[model samples]
Target: MAEITDTALQGTSKSPNTITLQEFNNRIKRLLADPSVMNCWVVAETTDVRINQHCYLQLLEKNPKTGATVAKIKAIIWGNQFRFLNARFKQVTGRDIGNDMKIMVCLSVNYSPQYGLTVVINDINPEFTLGDMERQRQEILNRLTQEGIIGQNKTVPVPPVLQRIAIVSAAGAAGYGDFMKQLTDNKYGVCFYPCLFQATMQGVKTVPTVLAALDKVEQNQHLFDCVVIIRGGGGTEELNSFDNYDLARRVATFPLPVIVGIGHERDITVLDYVAGIRVKTPTAAAEHIILQAANALAHIGDLSNQVVSIARDYIARAKEQLSYYAGNLPIMAQRIIDTNTLRLQNFIQNIPLHVQRRIEGENAQLARQKDAIKNAVAQVKMKETMRLEALGDKIELLSPRKVMARGYTLTTCEGKIMTDAAQLEAGKLVTIHFRDGKVVAGTQSVIKDK
Candidate 1:
């Protein structure tokens, strides 16, 4: 294309100050191609972005105060330049350029009669977009803090074991799949019941869809122990939706504790600040739940072991007490019998002396009186001996061992002697003791007399 000068337009025109459309376009191109204008830096908001072999965009400027579109221009990045710029942009900002994103680009001015003026973008400054995004993020955070709702979800109590979960993520998303896999395939063999609420996790629909999903989760909140929001890895552009104030507010004030794992390690969104817990990745979220359940299981196991230990110790002590009582009962009974027998023998010996003295004194009275006295003494001795024999027999029959031997048995329930049928329940376990051994039995039914 040839550059047309104002002097040349003057020379070629049969009509003064008039040029063909092609000539006019050429002039505009020539003027824009000035060395000073080449590779000039421009800042604009991107709209209607399209990527093919070459990336095309509509760069627009909006009034800062009124937010009304003021100036608009077409732009392009050649395939080679686009590849490098896009990669570098994503690297620096953790996001790819997309619609409605503010961006700065170095570009060269170009013009064509057919396609009109378009800027050829040579390079992009990712920091510009990053600064814009950070500014918006900070605004939302400040608003939440002012409302005092930033810590609302954090105050929600999480259960000791998170067995039931409400998951918010795009269905079949890599992050969702990873979370489920990590949660269900845990080494602890813990069980989890997760109900997924599908939503678009990126782009313009991200905020509304996520809010709807959270609403659904709230509807069935009782069914879930906590709510988990997760997304797979994506460019920072995709994460911008999570920085939305509406989504953040909803998550912040949610009734159930909210756990967010929506970004990479360094990718923190507004949701991260308001959520009850935040983790780096979806897998990390799953690991957290699994860890809680595993810990609870471990605690239960410890408690069970302690209970068993206590019960065993109690049984050991009971057995020792029973053994001591069983061994001493016979000895105690025999000692009582021996003491009584000695008293009877002493009485019998004194009776003989008293009888001899009575007989000597009565000898002068009469032989008949003496005979009667001797017979009475003999009868008294025989009677006393018979009474001692009877007393010993009564003692032997009243002994526990003797009673058990004579068709009697002892029964206990829950380690206590069961003296009444009222204490027995239908399915109660009881121990029945005989003189020789013990039997354990369960009650089929209990009958108590009125």
Candidate 2:
């Protein structure tokens, strides 16, 4: 490097009218201020900015892919133009004037005698940054698609009613406030229970902070029906965190369905594509919930109306059927009464003749029954008397008196009747009984009969 500097100095030494470096620099200033140089726009990345009376920046143009520096120059926004260009940049991008941002600046080329060659940034074009942002978003989306997670949250079924919701947002954000108010005062009178997991929703820390909030929700996923990410209105550039790949992936693959209402109108973030639903604003998200409940309730009401209509039709048909039955009631009743009266009159006219015939038959039957009963009684009594007479004869034959009269006499020694001669002693008094009388005797002699 020193050899190069010395060689360049050697060439300057060759000029006999060697001008001061300041004089040379002053000449270059005259050349750069020409219309052609001053009118050009240059694209570069800001670096090493120093902000004071002027905002001095080192602007670098680098290899887009390799990132090798191709050009570097000193640049400045003078205190006068600083206010205008910074405001314009911020107005378009929702970002502060800062280092590392790709910027397109229209330059007023300058060569300062003391400060050397530099450019004054006269104006900024925010469109270039916006275009780059769109490109980055497309690239992130493509990567997510390739990974097959782009539709992860989209595949998650949105509940018919999301009564419990977990929210990720800054605690004091206007978006959060609007969401709560809209849900609380919904025309449908639907109720929603919301839990806030507060996180920074803008700036570089936004992604990680919101991711942490998501993790908290995941730990208690059963408590929530869905997750909602909300941010207050801001410039399109403020949506960088929502477009961040990690945050987008987290949202895309979250277990619960995610509803995103972060960016302003028409601004699509990568998170929006992967989330279950995307709405224009936080209030819209709340309204969507209300609408869901209202629609379901309306369906119930419609069914009730259908049931009532069917019931009314059935009742009308029944009424018609009853009217037809009523119209025929008198005729049917009279026909039935006429048939019954004819039957009753026929029965009444036959009554006397039926009674006379019945009585004659009954009298004949009674006489026959009386004769049969008398014969049965006479036969039963005759048989019973004959049996009694036979029984009496048999009894007379078995009588003891009749046996005595047949010449069998009873003898007694003293009082008891004796059947054996051993009952008397040789001199004992004895009595004998014949059929007619009793005889007194003495057992004076003993005799043994062979």
Candidate 3:
């Protein structure tokens, strides 16, 4: 050892050791803070991510071939940058990057011996994130299908009429407003009792926040008839949150019917597939409800009209029957009267004819007997003429008509003949019967034997 100078004592340093590890790190930090050596470059794949409460993110990248982490660094996104990054990422990927997603980042390299790490993030490439989103969507879809929960939500019964609805959406979102207005202004007078289960509609925390809202609705199943998940218009990337398999499973197994109104006609999510009903927009969902209500009302109206018509027909038939009976009543009564009058006339005519015939026959028989008696009396008078000459003379004396013929007129009162002088009275009107005629006479005198 030659007598080394004080400089040689530090192993013959070519330059003086003027900087410490802390000093070098501070200098490098200052240089990186400048907008020159710290440039931006896009890299693939995100790894080893940490989030701080200050809204700064620390991330790293690794090499897939070697299974080794070559790019180990500490990258920071400030609170403001973090917000922008989160929003942009969600806009591009429809999801926020945490530990789960892979992202393409624009970053700067930083090297320092004391800090012993490098930083490499400044921005993100949206196109690359979108591509990643498609792959993730397919993966989740496959998982749900394999897990047999793809058709789970479809099994829940949708109410025949969608009256009470539970909505999970960002409050004040244009989508929510549209849905409410459409339902309220429906022409069918459809009523909706909307119970809002508010949640984040987009971002890294969107899935969990939405799931929590769904959980509340599920726990209180009686409060709602159906669950509706709706969102405002957005890019395809922003819709990726709905493709999650876990969220799909939850929706599939929900007790009540689920409806999704998430995107336009071109966009279809896993949630849409799992939901019992999927509509292109929130307004369309409202229209579906109105249509169901209209159909029900129309059916009821038809039934009511049918019932009324049937009642009217029955009344008309009854009136016709009553009129028929009333019209026939007079004719039936007249027929009865005519029949009874004909029978009484026939009976009276027959009775009179029969009585007249019977009286005429009896009179004829009496006449014949009288004639025979008269003939017998004449023969007897001829045979006894000689012997009865004296009797004949006596009979002639007793005969009143013979006495009247002999100029002795017979006087009778009330059909009795007056044959004695005692029957005469003074001032009495009497009938005198001769053999040929009767005379009215007044008695002049009367005498009575003592």
Candidate 4:
């Protein structure tokens, strides 16, 4: 046998010859950088994936058949490739590829003769990414349904306009930017005052960060009209965080209506089910606001038009009434004039004729009265003359001279005509009266006139 040298001979030295855990891990990382035995494709279920600040990932894969884990690998995704991968995954699936996702990845195997083994990812398939997202989505939906939070958010009332908005999203996501821009640019005079409750929009920390933001919004309840959870563009994997039962409960029981604009068109999440309104994208949510405002404006315009029409109708009616009265005015004036003129003409025609007729009748009556007076005076004069003539005749007949001429003598006694002889009895003295003269005689013989 060859002489045992210091290098060849084995001895249990006082100090151990093996490397420390830290040094071994560093050597394995260095070996992973080699090009030969490291390159391969892995189809595995990611049980755990932790992303560090430096963009390195720790991945663990498990076997689905045995329910036993078969591979554990330390993986790295450089910042540039990580960003591209993240963007691409989100563009395809509307989510981020993270833990609990089954992926077929192109990786480089890293083995160190001194240390251990690891893997580094180079490329990813987007279809597998969507598959992973659908699986997680189903799981979350089942969980939320079991917990009774899915139905609650659907029952909330959505305000006509979400004027005060509490937004939970990554601070500078394009979706958030688009939403804000659309709201601000609204033509319907809608004003949105958004309270930004920033959070991680993707990855393992998304659920906790978003929940924290929601809690903050809840605490400051006076600041918001409704809550909006928006992720502009991301893989559906990121939406898995929203399916958490606790998060769903928080959204369902929020003091205000919660509006979700997750921008994933393929499937609805538990958060969507719980929200008062679910919009497919941030821009679509903005469009809803615009539509509401447009409707209000149209209603106001209709009212204004109706008011104007009513006023116009009233004016027209008043004008028609005025025209009716105006048309009747001339007829009324003509009737009054014609009535007065006819009365005047009748008076004028009757005045002189009535006066002349009355004067003629009076003249005829005066003539008749004059004729009667004349007749009465004549008759009285005639009667008086006749009586005088008759009286003269009687006097002539009774005259003494006439009696004498007729062979008759008159005798009288005591200067009175003697009509009886008996009155002359042996008287003392007697006088006789004749018609012309009287005589006094003594009685020689008594004689009687028979």
Candidate 5:
């Protein structure tokens, strides 16, 4: 692609004011070397950026809609200044000064007979690059958000117990070691099975290698509870790979929950926002898993304690209830028996007095009839007294109170009457109801007659 420069002196050769092309280019270069044009700002979009001995940049202005170049210029950044300038550019914008970068470069217009015309770029304003980066990042993030990809991986729930973990990182990285130590050998003595799917943690191969590792984990997804990505041991000087749009899309829409620990203390990568969970360092991510195991143990311990305590409390309450029944049962039964006995005794004493009064009244009536028939009256009075005495004895013999008083007793157990001798067995408790009182007794032994 040819550079856009001043046209050659075609008809100016006839004019003496313009000399040969070589002399004319040299004179024009000398004139443009003023204080203002020697080192001034130029805004253009970079096209071809090649780096061998020196950095070569092809700057161009393109039609916004048509994508056709409207203007083009050649630019160069010396190798001597590339180191500090590239570092500063990446630090401020979180990306390298690469092709298609909209930049503001400080350059000097140079015209040479051999090299034609070019711009010698010496300095750049990183602020422009930063603004452009922000704009691009915002656009990508917004598109992802609108497409509803941001929460796709977030919807996958992390398993309650973290045992199998598929890790993507450099195999011998310090970050990986720290994560393993924190997880497998935690203070709680929890064991974790960490499988390493090694990948390049940084540089050009970072995104592709990590994505490949993720794909492998996905293939064996059933074997793992979750996926963890850990990268530490270096600064975020080349962390733009983490913010790659393609990689971010894959991570944000993963089938399983993704845990990222990229070890960046400065700006968060787009991966961090799209991941199911993000931690500052690999060890911190490990701690989060260990905490889950610890909490599970704690929850189980609490439930066990609750069950044992409840059982003990139930047994104690049952014992108290049994003791209450045992202590009050006999006393209540005895009180009822005593009241019935006292009423029966009063009725028996009144019966004898009433019989004596009835016999005296019969004797008085016979005496009044003695004046008419004295001999028959004496015989009749004796027969009547004898009959009354026999009736009183029969009544006394038939009474339940009298029957019990004659060496007979009714036995009951727990308030139920016992009718058979079989009911009187060893270890069986019974109450004996006598004529005057009752006795509660537990059977120590049973005796049977042949």
Candidate 6:
């Protein structure tokens, strides 16, 4: 440590005094080392919290209304103290010191020539943060109630069979894996189509990423029957984001029913209140869906059995009807045959007498027709004989022998008979014939009549 002088503390601009960096820091250290102000409790919001072997962070005291920082200080916790304080805080509040956390911490002011001013945190009042968180949560609940949206999702009906699911979760989280495993390996062999919309489930990004995931699910709402927000296997610090007003409101009014299972039994968030269905763990959410599907399947099986029973009953009735008809068929057929046989016997007895009467009448009618035919044939023969005799007389009057006998002579030239002078030539042979004689002579010159 360097020496401090009175001149360094009181100096004019004309003769300015200088002090070594270590000397200046040593003076500040002495002032802060007072017993009254050395170790005390301060309430502030945590910021830039980094935890490892030791914890390093900033404490911020802000104006309540404006939310502008009024005081800021560098703070840290040594490895051993941080372990004890964090363990105790987690046990009490279900959370460790995290960014934006309101805390009342017991700290001692420290200054070093090399390290400047910083507060060393020794213990924390977990109840203070816990109370503040509860107050904020209540305020959110009141706002949601006033808006009348806190029970909106609860009003949506979960489908009897939850086949398609829109899941908002960290893709690789142990909770998501456990949920999928339980659904896949259920004893009832139920199937689920769980499409994951990945989001950060913890830390500063939790609220926005989850809200974005819900928006995506909304855009494709037709693909899912319900929404499942599952963040299994995370500490209570991670659960704080689920209490956010914006995230809770979004879940409460989402179009599809939302199921929240964040894997915490001791701590419940505002989300649990707003969600349609809330369960302790991802496995429980899976089991709920499986049970619904199993019930629906059982219902379907029962309906199928009922249909089979009805069909069997119908078939049994049809068989009885057929059997009744078969038993009466032979008697009905025999009665019809006996009636027809009696009618045939009566018709056969009248057949011979009817034929005999018909034959006698036909024979008398034939005798009458024979006499009429004989008269017609005799009249026709007499008419034809008179016509033939008149023809013979005409033929006798025109005969050549008859003409010659009546003094009409016939002349012939060689074998042809000549009736004209043009048929005769000088010195041609001629023949003249009378009734019973013929003369042959040499012809003289024939003359034409003038």
User: For candidate 1, lDDT tens digit of each residue in 1-450?
Assistant: 999999888888475677798888888878877888688898999999999999999999999999999999888999998999999998888877778889999978877778887779988999989898899999999999999998999999889999899999988799999999999899999878999999999888998888999999888888999999999887777888898899899999999989999878988999999999999999999999999999999999999999999999999999999999899989989999999999999989899899998998788678877888999999999999999999999999888789899879999998999898988899989999999999999999988788
Instruction: Quote model 4's TM-score.
Output: 0.49
Q: Residue-wise lDDT of candidate 5 within 1-450, one digit each (tens)?
A: 866555654424564564687888777778876788788888889978999878997999889999999999878888979877988987887667787679999988777768777789989999987776677777778888999898788889888887899999998889899998888778888888889999998888999999999999999999999899988845443666787888889999888789999865665778888999888889888998899899999998999999999999999999999899899989978988999899999989899898999999999988877766977888899999999999999998898788897889988987788887776779988899998999989899877676
Error of 1 at 287 (Å): 2.1
Q: lDDT by residue for model 2 over 387-410, one digit each (tens)?
A: 999999999998766777998877
TM-score of each: 0.66, 0.60, 0.52, 0.49, 0.59, 0.63
Show model 5 residue runs off by greater than 4 Å: 1-25, 31-40, 44-91, 94-102, 111-118, 233-237, 325-450
lDDT of 3 by residue, 1-450 (tens): 578687667776477668776887887677767666466564545545566742434454667687666654456665667778788876665556655456667676676755555664567776786776778778877887888877877887776777888999988899999999998998766677888899988766779989999999988999788999999787665776788877888888888888899977767888887888899998888887788878888988999999999999999999999999899989989998999999999989899798999899999999999999999999988888866887888898898777667787767876777767676679888997778987897877787777
- The top-ranked prediction according to lDDT is 1
Candidate 1 displacement at residue 319 in angstroms: 2.7
Question: Residue-wise lDDT of candidate 6 within 90-129, one digit each (tens)?
Answer: 8888877789889998889877888787789978899998
Order by TM-score, highest first: 1, 6, 2, 5, 3, 4
| Best by the TM-score measure | 1
Root-mean-square deviation of each candidate, in angstroms? Answer: 29.0, 18.3, 31.6, 34.9, 28.2, 20.0
Better structure of 2 and 5 per TM-score? 2
lDDT of 6 at 49: 93
Runs in model 4 lying further than 4 Å from the true structure:
1-100, 103-132, 146-148, 219-223, 235-239, 264-269, 322-450
The lDDT of model 2 is 0.86
What lDDT is reached at residue 225 by model 3? 83
Tens digit of per-residue lDDT, candidate 4, span 1-450: 778887754564576688788887777667667666555777765654555543455566666688677777667776678788867876886656666667777887765656456456788787886776667667766776787766676676766556787888887899889988998998767677887899998777888888899889988987677788888755555566776766777787777777888855765777787788889998888787678768877988999999999999999999999999899999989999999999999989999998999999999999999999999999999999999999999999887798876656677665666677777776546765454575677876776667
Report, for every candidate in turn, its global Cα lDDT versus the true structure. Answer: 0.91, 0.86, 0.78, 0.76, 0.85, 0.90
Better of 1 and 4 by TM-score: 1
